[model samples]
Target: MFKWEQLHQYGILIIVLEENNEAKWIIALGDDFYYDQNTMEPPVGDILLYEAALEDNEVIPLQYQKE
Candidate 1:
């Protein structure tokens, strides 16, 4: 599971790389609702990549959606 609280505590930025090579920012927050985060809006897909902000952090694959 992608834990926003855990990510936030480490000051990480979730970067989503699209097929076109563009990167989108993922905002993690404690709220259940997607609208609660000011930086990121709801994504329109089920699969994405989640990573930590550190240079040595590994990227984790995630399937997420707004409930």
Candidate 2:
């Protein structure tokens, strides 16, 4: 939850890191469909850490797709 950059052609990229300062994840939006493929599976405590973009103060709106 620090750096924020705006892409010219694509969209925005939000970087989220793990507490151990090792594992990392990127939240990207625009021109892409984000969904939790394991929605029917068990919780691994890694929901937002997956594909779906995590919202912030800069997040505008999210178009939810019917699964």
Instruction: Name the candidate that leads on lDDT.
Output: 1
- Stretches of candidate 1 off by over 4 Å are 1-8, 14-40, 44-59
> Model 2, range 1-67, lDDT digits (tens) per residue?
5333321222334444443344344444444434467686432322222422355434334434446
Error at 65, model 1, angstroms: 1.7
Q: Lowest-lDDT window of 10 residues in candidate 2?
A: 43-52
The reply for model 2, stretches above 4 Å from the true place, is: 1-11, 33-67
The number of clashing residue pairs in model 2 is 0
The C-alpha TM-scores of every prediction are 0.21, 0.23
Please give, for residues 1-67, the per-residue lDDT of candidate 1 as tens digits.
4333333222433333332333323434322324336666664333334442456554444646568
Task: Tell me model 1's lDDT, rounded to 2 decimals.
Answer: 0.39
